[model samples]
Target: MTHQVHLGIALERAGWHPAAWREPSAHARALTSPAYWRDLLRTADDAGLALATIEDALSLPDRFEPVDALRPGRVRGRLDAVLIASYAAPLTRRIGLIPTVTTTHTEPFHVATGIQTLDFASRGRAGVRLVAGASAAERANFGRRDIGVDVFPASGRVEDSPEILAAFREAGEFADVLARLWDSWQDDAIIRDLESGRFLDADRVHRIEFEGEFFSITGASIVPRSPQGRPLLTVLAHQTVPFRLAAEHADLVYVTPHDDADVVAIRDDLDAAADDLRRDREPLRVFADLLVLVEDTAVAARDASQRLDEWAGEPLTSDARVVVGTPADVVDAVRELAASGVDGVRLRPARQPADVVAIAEKVAPILRSAGVLREDADGASLRTRLGLTRPESRYVGEKVAL
Candidate 1:
């Protein structure tokens, strides 16, 4: 059977391009409004896309410059990603809402409960993209740990810095705590029995008591076991440190592979890491990230990309491979990626609503017809849709000795 590739959208304020806000079709004035996110998410859901990952950060997009000296052209400001996902949940039924949550500054307990609440709200359609906040501004916002100014060096290689690597290591521990907390409450822990006036079975809840280099949690989660046992854990990895983190903790790993060979190489690295780590569970899923600008024709797409680049004062540059073409071109690209062994592709649109509409109306139908994209199964949870089984709680069989 041909492997059906999962499709997702990485939603930014207006779009991924720095100058996307200047576009006539961009919702520049309403970036924080509920209607803007609602429309975009509804489009993705209706398009039968598998998931939508909301981008977030504690600091503004421009990390280097002072807030007062920030450039005027780029878009700025965003509401809380978890809150946005919760707001969009009722409005969208099918697509998984995976919001980015920075683990460096935020406490693991808060992250665990917040995502648990989101999972409950979305009825198991929620996931979180784990990220480590590295900027001094973001660190200042929390007034927590002090990181060196040169954590992100001139070479643009993040893993080269020990501080950054340590942050990722902390994030891995953060992910571990989140998972343990999610499994703290057994599935049947809650029982509303009027006869005995019993609200919960105390025996069924387990204290995780997780102690690590970054965090130490000593009890069961305040929140009950979520619908999927644990919502999906995801990480966007570009190098070895993050690749190992994803292999060890993430259910899904998003990778920036510039070409087919890159895809194969990344897959090999992930597999090797998983092997070295002695991962005993199901292998994590890999999704290649693409920054896309699709139009009616190749010329139209190129023209649109050029226009955006001109507006931005530079050509579009992304960690992911940039694709500019028509629906057929996109389909061919997806087909190639599938052949290259990627389980999915997360497309970051260069423009809002316009590229979103194109992906839904034009691109998706062609892929579905080609057997590359599968139709969404009605009423399926995000895990079910992704072919992941709902895991039983680790504390299920552990009963309190009388």
Candidate 2:
């Protein structure tokens, strides 16, 4: 197939594996250090990976569990994902830095400006993974909304839960507000004409008076028009509600497909959602999420995975499929995914630094050689590299109309 895969890595504190921090190569102690993040991102940047997504959440890791029932040995705590991405901006170039921004608790205005600032900091290589905060524990931190007693009722599918559906709906509106805010200032709004003694053209800025079910955001973004105009927006979707949200607002959507059938089914669902919504933008770019552990040999990789699972006192389980194998094995899996019509794969390294290093040094080369991975487009913005156009502001002529 001629379709080139967009490879991305998901960065967690130590790694996705609960016992990853126990690994010798894991930078457990340096989890909060900038140097650690710098090294990890530099590795991906040098390897020609398309993007790196920094995961975030309001509550501590494993907050879903009761305090007494919380697992003890797992890696806990995290620096702000946006700050981490911003810190890595000057440290590397090329790879897109997408930080998770929980929409449930954050103000849309803050979200827009913060990401716009990141776009400026990264020179256009910035994106955000918009996620909704679901945990009651997480909600307690903000105390802004009451999502009812049963966050995920035991009776129905978690995604079908009323509170969960409401959260996704709110998140969709949140995304809409962000888009409006990002476009409030026209690209040429800043004239910088010193002779005229004017910094900006008043007619070029428009106020977005948006009032939604969850949020009401007013006016232009505090930040200027960013390098990519509106930076890339992404969402991770596992169910119909979220798929609809992604279809409506995301430039890219990360999905978990356990098999070839799943890949096709999920793609169909996303397409159906976009069609149903009458989405006029480009079709959402689909990236399958995978928890990966790679080694020189298949046996060795499985052994490592088993060892990590043993350390954690349970086998590794994830919403995404877990792949434990050699580089060649990974290439084969990716080949299958590509044939199944996935635009890309975002691998969550089972062990930080170690698994990520292996992915960059080993798996990436084979994918490139096999023509599954795309060649690097040097000095391209994240949107350009992902083949997405830098969009024009939706409110371009609004001031004139008024």
Candidate 3:
């Protein structure tokens, strides 16, 4: 049997289509409100989606909708990925929640613990998609000295400059530290033997004294015993070093591709990296990221894309675009991608209601009927959903001489 592909939709309250907000089916205020997310999660759950990825960013919507005219960088957003998972936890029973977090602004200690909390809070249905801070704009938001949007922003700088490679290395190191710290507490540490008034077996907890060029964090999280142990470590890599980081640390990686050729090349890169790392990254699910704008008809969707581009004061993206199409068309693209070593596709619709509802109602069913999607959501936590087993902590029994 062919390995079945999974379907995941990134939620932004509205659907993924840019004109989706204008569509009668979309809800206006939900894009920036918690209630909006809750409603959508339920929609995905009802549609039986495998996962819902919530994007965490300081800036949002890029533009606005009549529903809720967002003054980009002004209107506060709904709760971020972790909180979204917590909010959706009780409402929907399945649907793995993967939230994107920037390793640049946050300390590994904080993220490591918070993700673990999600696992516990959501009953082991938490995953964090890690992305290196790429924009000077984003860096500025966090008050960090950042780089511009161009690839490897400082690649040719003659003076002291942080290149893209360095940024990824730093982010990789950050993930490394998070993994180590997560394992710093052993699984059996929670021996609540109240008879002796000892809540924890101290011998089970390990300390990680990780010191890298970028950072050093002492081991042992304030919160211990996460349900999934490591939850799910994922990184979206569009370049080399980040790709390598995914090979080393990420259980699931999201890759960007211009087309089929790009997808094949990335698959080859990951295969080579897996060989170098002596890790089985081959079956390491690579999910293609697409900014979608699905519509009832291709022509209408195309025109809508054009209109949205005009609104943004620029043309729709030339590359990495999953333009207007029907559910069958989207499935064809998804099937081709899966054959090219993509385990799935994560869609970011310029939307709130239409794209998401369509994905769940239309795309997911098409994928399922085509024998490509998971048949059911039972026995699926974020880890198992991505096919990763429990990870062994780097701090299990070693003491660094440093």
Q: Put down candidate 3 lDDT per residue, 194-261, tens digits, no spaces.
A: 78989977766776777897888775788886878887778777656667888887788888887888
The reply for model 2, stretches above 4 Å from the true place, is: 61-63, 148-151, 155-159, 400-402
TM-score of each: 0.96, 0.96, 0.86
* Model 2 C-alpha lDDT per residue in residues 151-205, reported as the tens digit of each score: 4566546465777777788888999988888888899999999999999898888
Which 10-residue window of candidate 2 scores lowest in summed lDDT?
Answer: 148-157
Residue lDDT tens for model 1, 1-402: 666899999998899988888888888989989999999999999999999999998887455556456677888889899999999988888899999998888888998999999999988899999997667777667777677333465677766787787888889999999999999998988998999999998998888978999888898789999988899999999987889999899999999998877888898889999998735777688888988888898998888888989988999888888889998888888888888878889999989978888999988899898899966687788888888889888777787421
**Cα error of candidate 1 at position 274, Å:** 1.1
Estimate the lDDT of model 3. Answer: 0.71
Which parts of model 1 are misplaced by more than 4 Å? 63-68, 148-151, 154-156, 400-402
RMSD of each: 1.8, 1.7, 4.5
Q: Which stretches of candidate 3 lie over 4 Å from their true place?
A: 1-3, 13-24, 58-78, 144-161, 278-283, 395-402
